[model samples]
Target: MTTRKIVVSALVSALAGGTQLAQATDVFRLEGFGAISRGMGGTAVAHDVGPAGMMTNPATLSLMPDGDQAMIGLDLVTTDIKVTNKATGESVSSDTHSNNRGPYVAPEAAFTKRIGAWSLGVGAFAQGGLGTEYGNGSFLSRATGGLATGLDNSSRLLVLNIPFAASFQVNDKLTVGGSVDAMWQGLNLDLLLGADQVVSLIGANRATGSLVGVLAGIPGLSGAHFSLTKDKFLASGVDAWGYGGKLGMLYKATQDTTLGASYTLKSQMNDMEGGATLTAVTAGGQIPLTGKIKIQDFQMPSHLDLGISHRLTPQWTVAADVSRVFWKDVMKDIKVAFVADAGGDLNILLPQDYKDQTILSLGAAYALNDSLTLRGGLRFASQALRSSTLFAVIPATPRKHLSAGFTYAFSKQAKLDFAYSHAFKETMDNTSLPNTSAPIEVTHAQNNATLNFRYSF
Candidate 1:
C-alpha cells in the first residue's frame, strides 16, 4: 500500500480506539468540527478551512489555500453523569454517580489537495461515544429482602467515520462539494434485569410461561417464586459497518456575506455479531440467556444544515448556523432476538421518542494581531428525547454550551490552535417500566478542550 494510505488507515484506527475511553456528550454528536470551529461554536459550513471542513461541509474545501494543507486535532473531554432511582417498598432508593468514563482524548486528521478549481480530501474523526458504570451495591431489593442487592450495570458505544470528498469552484459566486463516508460503530451494554419484568416472567402464580427454575430462597422476591427471564448482566456488544454521504453548497452572496447549506443521508449498519449473553444466579442454579438486536433498520439519522458568515470589518468575522436532525424513526424502539423463547421475541420499547431536534450556533472571531486570533461562541439545543425514555448509559440531554479559543501562527506555514467548551449542568427525569414510586432522575454535564496543529505548503 502507499505511504499516504498507510497513514490514513492508522489515523482512523487511532480514533476508533480512543473513543472507547470517553463518555457520551452533546447527545451523540460533538459540539464542533475543530479548534477553529469549536472556538466559534462549530459554525464552519460558511467559513474557510482545509481538512477541518471535510467533516463540517466538503464545500469549504474550496475555500482553502491553493496549495496542499494538512491538520491533526485532539480533543480532551471530561463528563459528570449521575442517576437517581426513587425509593420504593422493601427497596431503598439510590443516587449514584457514574464516573468510570473520561479523562479521555479523541483525535481527528485529514489531508487536502487543491488542483486548479477543484479540491480532494480524505479524513477520519471520532463522532461521539458514551460509557457508564454503576456499582453493584447501589441497588437494593425490597422484594428479595436485599439478597440481590448487588447490581452490575453499565454501557459503552462509539462511532468512527471516514469520509472521501471533493469540491469544485463553479464560479466566483458559488462552490459545490460532496462526500461519502464509511461509518463503523461499536456498542456494549451491561444492564440489570427489570424487577417488574422479572416478576411477570417467573412469579410462581403467573401461569403464562413454564418455569424452568426459580430463586427459591431469595427474600427480595417478597414471598413470591420467580424464574430468570434475563441475565443479571446482559453484555450485548457488536462492531458493525455502514455507509452515508453529504452534499453541500457555498454561495458568495456579496462581498461581505457567505451563505451555505448541506444535507447528510443516514448510515445503515449490519447486525451486531456475537449478540448479547445473559447470566442468572438462583437457588436452582444459573441459567445463561442469549440474544441479538433485530437490526431490521439500525441506522444513524439524517440532518440538514444552513449557515451564514459575514465580514463586518477587516479584523472581525461573524458566523451563525441552524441544523435539524430527524431521529424519530431510528430511535423509538429496540428488539432483541433470543436464541429460543416461548414468548416469541423480546422487544423493549425505548422511551427514546427522540423528536426532530434543532440546534443553533453563533460565533465571532477577531484578528487581534499579525499572528493571533481570538474567538468565542455559543451553541443551543432543545431536548432530544423525552424524560420518560431517559436512561443512565446515554445521557445526551444538555441544552446549552459556551466556548472560547485562540490561534497562534508561528510562521507562514505552521499554526497552533486551542479551544475550550463547557456544557452546563442539566437534569432529566425518567419512568421505569415497573415498580417505580417516582420518576428516575439523571443529571449530566461536560467539559471539552481542543488542540490542533496545521501546516500549509
Candidate 2:
C-alpha cells in the first residue's frame, strides 16, 4: 500500500481517541507553542519556523530552508493565583498561593529530512496540560488537620502528542501536508471538604444530594449523611489515551506574500479509569477505604487556524493569524461513576459548559544583520469558560499577552531562539456555583519564557 493509505488507516484507529488531565491553567492553548512561534505571538501558520512550525502547520515544511534540520526547546511557565474563600457568611482570602507543583516545564523536539520537494518530519511534545498543587489538607479541608498535617490540595493533567508528518509541494505556488498523532493524558486530583462545604455540596451536587436524600425520612439515619460528608477525603487519579489528525495547506499568493490554513480534529479518548481513596477522621485516628472511579464523556477541543504573511523587504516581514477553538463539544461536562467499598454506589456529573473561543495574533520580524533577528507580537483570546463554571483546578483565563524576543546565530549551522511573554493579571469572579456557595473569586497572572536551539546540516 501507499504512504497515504497507511497514514489514513493509522489515524482512523489511533487519532480518533484521546486523555483526562485537568484543564490547562496557563494562558490557554499551551501558551503559543514555543520560542520561535511565541516570539511572533504564536504566528507559525504563515511564517515558517523550522521544527516549531511542524506542530502548527505541517505544510510549512515544504517552505523551510533546504537541509536536515533538528531542534530542541523548553517553555518555562510561572503562574500566580489567588482564591477568595466564602465557606462562612463572611469572606476571607487564601493568602496568595503560587503553584506548589514546581519545575513547571514544557519540552519539545523535532527533526526534518528533505528530498526534492518532499519534506518528511517527526516530532514529540506536550500538546497542552494545566496542573496545580495546593496543600491537600488545607483550604477546604481545614477540619482534617488543615495546612500542616495532610497532603496538598492539588490536581494535574498532562497531554502528550507525537506526530509523524509529511509535506509535498504541489507546484511552485502551493504545498499540502497532514499528520496523525498518538495522544495520551494523565490526571490526578485531591480535594477535602468541611462541614459547611459538605452542606453546600449536599444541596448543589446532584450525586451527593440524591444519595443523602434517601436517609432523610429516617430520623436516626439522616445524621449519618453529614458524618460521611464531613471532613470527607475526596480524591482520585486516572490516565487515558486517544488519537487525532491535522491537515494544512500553504499557498504562495505572491512573490512576497504567503497564506496558510489548518485544522485539527478533536481527539476521542477512552473513559478515565482509576481509584480514589476515601478516609475520615475518627477518635481512633483515620479510617480509610478505597474504590474505583470512572470518568466518561471527555474529549479535547478542536481548533482551526488561518494566516497571512507578507515580506515588506528583504530584511523585514509581518504576519497575522486567527484561530478558533470549539471547546463546547469536548468540555461541556464530566460524568463520573463511583464504585464504593461500602457506602452504596453514587454517580456524579460535574458541569463545565465551556464555550468556544477565538484568538488573534499579530507579529513582525526585522533582521538586524546576517547573525541576528528581532521579533515582537501581540495576542488576545476571548474567554471560553463562563466565570461561574471556572474551577480552581483550571485557572487558565487570561485576555491579553505582550511578547518580545530574538534569534542569534553563534555559527553558520547553529543558532539560539528565545522569547518572553507576560499575561496581564485577570480576575474572574464567582467562579463557583452562583447561589449555593459563596462565589469563588479567582485571580490569575503569569510570566512565560522560552529557549530553543537549532542545528541544520
Candidate 3:
C-alpha cells in the first residue's frame, strides 16, 4: 500500500474508534430559549415576569396579577454548519443542513394572587425542545480507492417544565420567591453505519484478491481463492424521565433597581431501558445478536445565575446576567453491555468528566414610543461538551453572539416580538482516541437565527 492509502486507512480507523468511545455515553447540552424577545434576552425573564417566564424562572410569576394571563408564541430558526479536514485535501461541503425548523407553538398560562404580604402563583409551560436533522448519501459515502461507504445518524429531544412558586414581600423594597419544578424529558436516537458492498470488498481483498493475481499465478497458489466476508449492523433506542427544582430571590434594592439570583439543582433519571440489535454476516447466513441496556443513572448539571436589571428611565431599561454550569458534578463514566449471542458480553464505556462552562450576557431595551420597543444584546458562552465526546449525530458549535430584536404592542392585551442572533465562529480539535497515537481532527463552523411572536391576556 502507498503512504497515502496507509494514512487514509489509519484516519478512518481512528475516527471509528473515537466514535465508539462517544457512543458509550450520551451528553446533551441544548437549552431551549423562549420565543419571546425578553425571554430570549436574559435567562428567559426570571420565569414569571412575562407569559413565557415560567419556563425557566418560575418565581417571576409573582410579578403577575390575579387575572389569568395566557401567551402563545412561535419561533423560526435557521442554522448553517460546515465540516472539513485540514490534513487531507478531501472536502465535503453543503448548505443543505441550513433550514427552518419551527413555528412549533410555545404556549404558557399563569394565575397569580396576593394574600397578605405574599403572592402565590401557579403556571404550566413548554420550557423548550430540540429537533434537528442533516443527512445525504454523497457526504456519507465518500471513500478511498474508489470505494464508497454510507452512514447516517439522527436524534431528537422533548422537554416539559411545570412549576409552582410563592413570593413574600419583605417590607416595601424587597421580595423573595422560590419554585419546585416537575420536569419531563424524552430522547430518541437513530444511527445507521457500514454497508454490505463495502464489507464484500474487505472480504474479497482478504480472501481471493490478495492471492489470485499475477504474483499468485507465478507461485504454487495459482487459481486458488481464499477470502473472508464481513457484514454487521447495529441499532439501539432509549426513553427516560426525571424531576428537579429551582430556588430564586429578587431584591428590589431601590425603586428603579432590582437584583436577582437563582440556582437550579441537578436532576437524575433512573428508570430507563433500551435494546440493541447487532447482526454479523460472514460467508455463512446472518446471525442475530441482541442485548438489553439498563441505564442505571443519568444526571443533568446544576446551574447558577446572577442578574441585575436597572430602569434608567420610565421608557428605558438595561439588564445583564452571568451564569455558570457545574459540569464538574457530572463525573460518572457511562457503562453498557455489548453482548453477542455466542460471544458472551463485553463492556462499553465512556468518560463523563466534562469541563465547567460560563456564560456572560448583556442587553438593553428602549421603548421607541408607546407601542414599539427595540432591543439588542451580546452573549458569550463556553463550550460544554468536549470534542472527544461529540459524534456526527450531535453537531453543536461553541459560540459568541450578537443579537437584536423588537416588540410591538398591537393593543392593550396583545403584542408581537422578533429577534435575530448570529453566533460567531469557533473550532474544536479532538485528539483523544483509543489504541492510537495520532488524532483525527474534525472542524465545524456554525450560524443560527430565530424569530418569534408573543401575545398576552
RMSD of each: 5.5, 7.2, 14.4
Task: Predict model 3's lDDT versus the native.
Answer: 0.48
Clashes of each: 12, 17, 7
Q: Which stretches of candidate 2 lie above 4 Å from their native place? A: 1-28, 86-100, 136-138, 143-151, 193-205, 208-236, 279-287, 341-344, 431-436
Runs off by more than 4 Å, candidate 3: 1-32, 36-40, 44-49, 91-149, 191-236, 279-288, 331-346, 434-457
Ranking by lDDT: 1, 2, 3
Clashes of 2: 17
The better candidate by TM-score, 2 or 3, is 2
Query: What are the Cα lDDT values of the candidates?
Result: 0.68, 0.67, 0.48
Q: Which one wins on lDDT?
A: 1
For all predicted structures, in order, the TM-scores are 0.83, 0.82, 0.70
Candidate number with the higher TM-score (1 or 2):
1
Clash pairs (backbone) in predicted model 3: 47-53, 47-54, 47-57, 48-60, 48-61, 207-226, 207-227
- For residue 310, give model 2's deviation from the true position in Å: 0.9
lDDT of 3 by residue, 42-115 (tens): 44433233544444454455555544444333333343434444445444432333222222233334444567
